[model samples]
Target chain A: MSAAETTPQRIAGRGAAPQRSLWHVILVRPETMTLVLLVLAVILASQLSPFFLDISYILRSFTLSAEFAIVALVLTMVIIAGEIDLSPAANMALSTCLFAWAQASGVPMPIAIAIGLVAGLAMGALNAFMVIGLQLPSIIVTIGTLTLYRGLAQIIAGDKSIRMPEWFIGIDKVLVFGVPATVAIFVVVSLVLGLILAGTIFGRQIYQIGTNEVAARYAGIRTRRIKLILFLLMGLAAAIAGMLTASRLGSVRYDLGLGGELQMVLMAMLGGTYIFGGRGTILGTFLAAWLLVVVSTGMTVANLLPAIQLTVLGVLLIVAIIATNLIYSRAQR
Target chain B: MNALGRILARRETGIAVMIVLFALAVSLYKPQFLTLNSLRVILLLTPLVMIAAMGQMLVLVARHVDLSIGSMLGLSAMLTGMMFRDLPEIPWGLGFAVSIGIGTLLGLVNGALVTFFRLPSIIVTLGTLNLYRGLTFIVSNARQVDRQFIPADLKGMSQTSPLLGIPWIIFMAFAVALLTYWFAMHTRVGRQIFALGSNPIAAPLRGVKVTQVTLLVFAISGALSGLAGIMYASRWGFVNPSNTGFGFEFQVIAAVVIGGVSINGGVGSVLGVMLGVLLMGCVAAALPLLGIPGTAQSAIYGAVILVALLIDRSVRRQGIARFKAARA
Candidate 1:
């Protein structure tokens, strides 16, 4: 209706240019808007610090955001369903510990990988069960699991680093052009998951679940089963992220992901996932991940500390959330 | 037989049972736990938490949460520490009052955003939590204020025992508790809070100024946390960004939930929270006496809260069922 109203005013030449906006609003999402800002920052950073754009420096930094982005894609889906799995960071941390511990104890590599994946699935089931069966709030339940899973990591490793042996170190090495194999895996996972969220029937059901669970139930969407599956997907993503991060670092520590869960949520939220749920896209999330890394690199060029970058991120999160809501409301009208 | 009587009876009876059972268990384990000296510690511990939890309970009963409390507490601590170091000659009472004044403003922002933005309180605080924590960290970066920095006279007031051998801080906490209880039970503002919590849409339609009520409750939450902050500095004698009142936010929240304050908002008591905080205080104090390994009381705390939540969820369901049955 406003678009119709605006056509006349534009015709009357109230504003400059033919206000026929062909730009995709999805690309203009808050997280993506920040991505633009991030790119600007990257250019600025590279000009300031020669190290900012070095292949090795970019390789190291981008990979962390890459793994985070992969998991954020799945968590974006979970939050869209009006639930979240904060346990993922802790889940990955714990699984990484388990995998390394098993391998150190002379367990075969493939079996260790299987253990990591199963551990994640079981952890996911714990979350799914409480949220579905017990009807507990997902936020509180995840918080509990966050503590529980991290505590398990501490017990498994007990303040000691479990180093990857020669064989595992080989896995950590870059598969293509010394570009870090983990980053490649992250890119693939993000792509596949992005497709699942955007194109599939099951993906539509996820939107249905988040927008309104009762309505979905009334529409015979089998909300419960879909939720369980979505959570399992989130768990699997965390497991993958855990494997990648643990592989890259070549060591597992309990405190590895101490506060990363909240950071991921912030990243996902900054990436344009609506906190209230159901109104976000995975590609937007992926773009937002790159935005965070760019901003981090940008800060380094400006000689800003992580402290300032983090504070700016917090402020940016608040602004982006508020601005996104304002824009979404305006666009709707 | 009546509805009101049954709830009051249930809550009070529950508290009484817990108090007696806990007292018995403590006496059996340590024997000295029953002494007035140890009793003083338990009594001293409950009221301050109860004071902070009262405002938390109020906001919670109204169906909003403020994770900014930990941040607010951190802010309050830094401000208090600075005041002591900067103005060592200032009167104790005035220093504390100014500390509280700063806290009220901090909480007011949280209340305003949640009420006006139509944003979920959870996300608002999730951001503000980082924002506030970051602010505190920046303000007090890698700096420590020692006991010598605080005016000795002002510090003495916190430790001074005046109420029949109880610490003045303890008496002060109790007084605040009673005032809150009275304010909640006997005032029009309190009734409006109840009305809003039961049904927000209806309450506004019935002429309750919800924004005003929400702001007032948040201001109260901040003031209490400010008071608790000063008390904390005196007890601990130092503060750091790493571990200063770090887990207190969630613990206070968990305490309220365990005490049967509905997380959905509405229906809790200052008195109930008093018992709940005591329960937390006892467990913290008792674990070592019970010879529990390590200082990680959080594991025990998590287990206790989970069990309490399970029981509380069941009891709430039972109450709802009874209400439906009685209405039918």
Candidate 2:
């Protein structure tokens, strides 16, 4: 049994594997595909409209989805660890609503922010406990929490939008060396997470856990703890993203970031993250984020209705998953 | 006595008992809840969910889920609504064919993607959920079909009663449920679905047609959602692109789970699901009477789903333990 398990790992470790050409290595990677798609999207957008090639306009547009992109980086890790959290968008709504409501009701700014962050953490902990402690499936568990969190947000905010302090608004307008602050944060988070996923032993363990949980446990990895940490990080990232969104909009409402989970999942899937788990990278998600921004911005620039854009996004999600799955299966050969 | 014990031990009976208990508890606070008028209200509120839950139950029993049911409902209803507005001369009965036909086609698309590409149902349906919703918007130009556009005969389905003052829609919902119960219990393909869901790998070895069964469940789910779509038009007297069936999948899923349909698949009953829908109806009707705001409805649904999941887990564990003891 041990030998059967270790054989795949041994073959995957460079030494026992058959030699492959450099082109095969480069062309077969899902990340490479994502990069190619990114380039293709840029070209397509430019052809659709004359003004699409402006780097500044594209940069400005990137800020709109920067929060989702940041959360997608964390989401990529969670998917790699073979679990999913669909409630993050709802988490964003609830956390932000709490923050806004607290501040509006005469709470201090710092405490309100802390309240939001802690609430996000608690939500994550609940998910972790349900999934890890109770051994419930993450997909369904997250779906349940998604509804709960969104519903809680609705109950709290009750069809009203709460205004943020004037000074707290417009994080997107705050430029960092010619880039929007939100965009800058996305890039930095991507870089940090990318390195952690690619360079750390912890990252390899996550891959192992996703690949085979029993085998990973036998290999002495603390699978539950790792998953718990990932869920907590997901909650934290969602909270931060929520605040960023609140700042950008200058208000908070129950519907804040409504349907944002679709965008986040689309980014991760486009990046070639295997839905079943164990094979994905932050770099892929990073490139996919830009690809999405280009496609949506192009549609917006072309004066297409939002309905058409929604159709395009849905088609892209299905196609991306299919393409990524095919690419992975082929690469295995 | 033995037959009674067996019946009492069934999941359907448990759900029925819960419904009675819940309704009684609610009545303690508001005696009006027990009135026939309130019963009519509860029944009216549940027809759409009941229809959708039957479809969802089949999908769950097949070890798959259809998240796109809501979108399918919206798209079908939007199309039927458009037909009414554009071609007012067409017979009103043709709307059922159009709506159900569109739903079946959309469901087939989901099934094809899942079976052909071997992708997960959850992701595929999630994609189509957006796709269908987008199509609904595109088809309707983001406008709503007004009350005037809906046929008077169709709207009467919700108001006019054939028996006991219950709306025709209520009877129609029960008819669908009875049909589903027969289909699930009596049909060969129905048994095959349970067989396929219970053990997919061994199912092929047992001569079950995997692809066909999967496609069939999704198609059935889609068809039912489509039926519910037209019902939405009748009951509400209008169909809005975004508002028609938004968050509908959650409500159906919550009801199905609470009805004792296991998420792991291959175990459920039509009666349980029907009772579950009734329970949800009771809660919804009770909320306004109990002075709880409407906004709390979604939260309660969410909580109910989680609680149901916990219950499902414990029940399965107990079943396993009992089986072990019997073996010993």
Candidate 3:
């Protein structure tokens, strides 16, 4: 079922055309809030520690969350389409464990990587089939799969970290134009996804589906097919992220990227993506990712406890959603 | 007679049959699985989940989920543990009031966010799950409440049985279930919760105190989880900042869903939930006997949840078809 049926608040078709100023259009957007927050976080973080101002240090820290950030790009699309996938983090662990296990067992590295990608696609297909084919709710379906995938990863790896081949490690260390490869990948992915979300017919249809599925379907939007494709893309992105993580860590474990879902979802929410779906931008998430890195890295540099950082992220998620909801509801009027 | 027959053929019966079949199949593979000791093992594994599932059931029936139950359990248990460790002179019974009280407060925060702000409960709880967990670590300074800090009498609740060799915790879990049954079936507010979940818009129109009922379910859920938190210390005799109540929402959700509580809300039974808890306990107990690694248990739980979802869906479809047919 679509989110509109479950949630009480449903924003219908653009009600009326009220004359709006350019400044209202730009400054009133959730993306603008994200931008403001990014600046605020940077200034605040810099005040917290002298070392926080280092560009290279911040870039290095950005690489740490770059894997999740990359996945968040695709996640933004899925959420816009009015569904969610909580299983990607688990998908990362499972696919990477399979990749690492395959390579360690003497499979060709190329074949091993392919195996990982295909496994990720297959997991995505499973989610799509349950959600699209069986018509199950995405939230609960993904939660079930999340647990299943993580559990399977545990069974496969058994509390052991499978080491990656020497040459395959350190994708984060390869910098181009003073940016880590993973960080660069995150930026490129964000731009491409941002364009797809804003500039493509397909992207507009996703918003339509999220806004009202029955209306979209009646309008011949192929809602199920579009959602299926979105779920598949989510799976593929998660797989790529898994390999990136494995390369960075030089090993694969069942707990790889554990709780990464919270970070990815936090990115989406902080970027002003409405939790109930149908409104958000890739630009918001992109800036939010950097904002997160600055805040977290600042805390780390200042010797703040990780517990406090966790608290801050949690509070940020709640606050961001509340703020985004308020902005969208007001904008609708 | 036909209506009575249909009533007898309920989800609870189906789950009960599955439980028996599963036990018999396992026993065939290992005769020892049928022994009383194996039953004891299964029962022992269920008390914590059983307590939490009742609260989870109410939350689900209210059409809102509380993912933060696990973290609430952790935080409450940690705080209670800290009290025992530092205070030393306080009566052990106070831990119940304190843990449950803290859980109620945290749950009320969740309810407030969802009701007053109109945020979705799932997202709100997901946020608090991390928030409470981080608070637990901050409060405990990342230290575990060691076994020595836990009162011996509390720990003894798990081992010492007052009747029929069943531990006190098991009885406590049953008492909670019975209380939930009474609250859900006999109380007007209980039915109001159902009315609210079945149709939120219609609920307010019907004078169902939307905010009050919503907050009540969450508070009840929190209070029960608090009870489970202290029971966690009783059962395990220690509370680690990171490990206590970790991933507990999954296990409890699995049981509730397997009990045939509809995710769409306003449909559940205490008996079915109790049976679901037992089924999970059986599977957990059977794993070691069957030589399956403990790592596979979570996979089984996940698989069970999905399968249960499918079963619930099909049953719902059939019921809808039958309703249409009868009307025609």
Candidate 4:
């Protein structure tokens, strides 16, 4: 397999090609479709509530899911590399549980944070070992680890919520340049990851790997090492996200970020990331995170029940994947 | 080569030995651990999972998974419970048909999505998992069917044994296993499922109807899950919107995988699934005897899955290496 095989190709007319036009390129791209949807969502949200149009209100609300958004950027890269890490949310819970547990046990704050990061890295390394080293499928392995990590968190936290010190609480309240600290961090992380994915040789290699891992390896891409590093990055990102969540909520519990894997995957899928791998963009995911936050906030403000919201999210996930696959397959034809 | 052969030979025997050793270890720690009463406890605890694992085994053998089974179970159970709560005059026997019918419909939706829309089963089922759960909540009005509303006959199924100390429910579960074994081993379509999993590209060329087989497997899985749902109401005497059948998929998948049902598909056995369920049952029964916290049980199950995966991978590796050596 080659990059061309994985890359979406537009099925132009069989006869002589028509004149090139900006609209044609823009309309055919999934990213453009995402942008249109995002704008439509915002407009619909503002219509639902006059309060939704406020910039500061949206930014503040973005903080609620900013940690998930931040990690999703890294996840975009992982998905583009032909692998997935479903255990990240569980990683967040366990790492945050460890961090909080360490602090509660008289470990210094900085040391506790270090322990959390290290623990997360170790978890990722374990995943990398099983998936890359042992050559097992990532889906089942991560599902297994997802259970293990969440279970470990439950054992450590034991149904109790551990409160953070007053000074350590409310990262979202700590605004950076009048933006919530969490949102600012999310923006910064997205920009940096976006550039790396768009403009770096290493990033190109990720696509090549996803397009064809065996061919990439034969091409001397050091596929396993790259995947290992990507897994480690995933863990590190999840650790940071967990801490941000801890700071935002001002407490940690075993069930912290429970069922968040769904939201994270939803963001990626909605962003036009091919589920089979080899194509996606951070910009798409970045817009999608806000789109989701807006849509969810709109529903909440409109007094929709969380159960209904869950149904909406599930529907959105299926619809998004179907649309993305359709667009990609059409492009290939 | 011999090492590979030995591992292959021990797949079923391996689980049996593990179960025996686990029981022995627990018995040594507490002399009362091994007893007829304990056997009954394990047997009673296992029937629901044993039934569901049969469905999951077939799905896995077709190289797809059904994560929504838990939610399907919940939805079907809640529907069945609603019937019992609203219509006390009706006989409780029809609850099985109602639940199974609801489950099969849900399963057909999943199959249609995967087969017609051509979506990945994992993602499709993941979406449906939450979708069905939400539907359950909506239909039940977020309320639980109370113990009293559950028909007395339903609850009695757990207590009343048809023969000796074995309840009818246990017999029902084994009957499902027996039927699945016969279908998968003796039937042409069932064998085609294996052929499809082993080489999807070749399967269609060889005249297999991929869509129909896939639909049948998913429908069976859904129907069995539905059966498990009604049995849940029978055993527990109540059904909650949120709690019934929650995380049920993990338990069944764990049993199926541990039973030497390959996650990669195309291979599994009814005997292996039964032994897997029994092994899990033994562990669950021994936990209280060993003074381990109930909190540790979920973690143990998680760890068990990972450990099983490692063992499965190593065995496959040896098998592959032996194949390569033979070719060379």
Each candidate's chain A: what TM-score? 0.86, 0.94, 0.94, 0.94
Which residues of candidate 4, in runs, are more than 4 Å off? A1-21, B1-10
Error of 3 at A43 (Å): 1.0
Candidate 2 reaches a DockQ of 0.56
Cα lDDT tens digits for candidate 4, B205-272: 78889999999999999999999999999999999999899878878888889998888888888999
Q: Report iRMS (Å) of candidate 3.
A: 3.3
Q: Looking at model 3 chain B, which ten-residue stretch has the lowest summed lDDT?
A: B1-10
Sorted into a CAPRI-style docking class, model 1 comes out as: acceptable
Q: Model 2 interface RMSD, in angstroms?
A: 3.0
Residue-level lDDT tens digits of model 3 in A1-333 = 334373443434344456899999999999999889888988888888766778898999999999999999889889988898889999999999999999999999999999999999999999999999999888888889999999999999999899998999999999989899999999999989899889999989999998889999999999989998998998899999999999999989999999899999999999988888888999999999999998898888888788878888889889988999999988877
Give candidate 1 misplaced runs (Cα > 4 Å). Answer: A1-28, A50-56, A65-67, A93-116, A151-178, A247-253, B2-9, B15-37, B44-48
Q: lDDT by residue for model 2 over A162-231, one digit each (tens)?
A: 9999999999999999999999999999988998889998988889998999999999999999999999
Residues B159-201, candidate 1: write the lDDT tens digits.
Answer: 7776577666777777888998899889999988888887987
Tally clashing residue pairs in candidate 1.
1
Docking class of 3: medium
Instruction: Return whichever of 1 and 4 wins on DockQ.
Output: 4
TM-score-based ranking? 3, 2, 4, 1
- TM-score for every candidate vs. truth? 0.88, 0.97, 0.97, 0.96
Q: Give the fraction of reference interface contacts each candidate recovers.
A: 0.14, 0.69, 0.59, 0.51
The model with the greatest lDDT is 2
Clashes of 2: 0
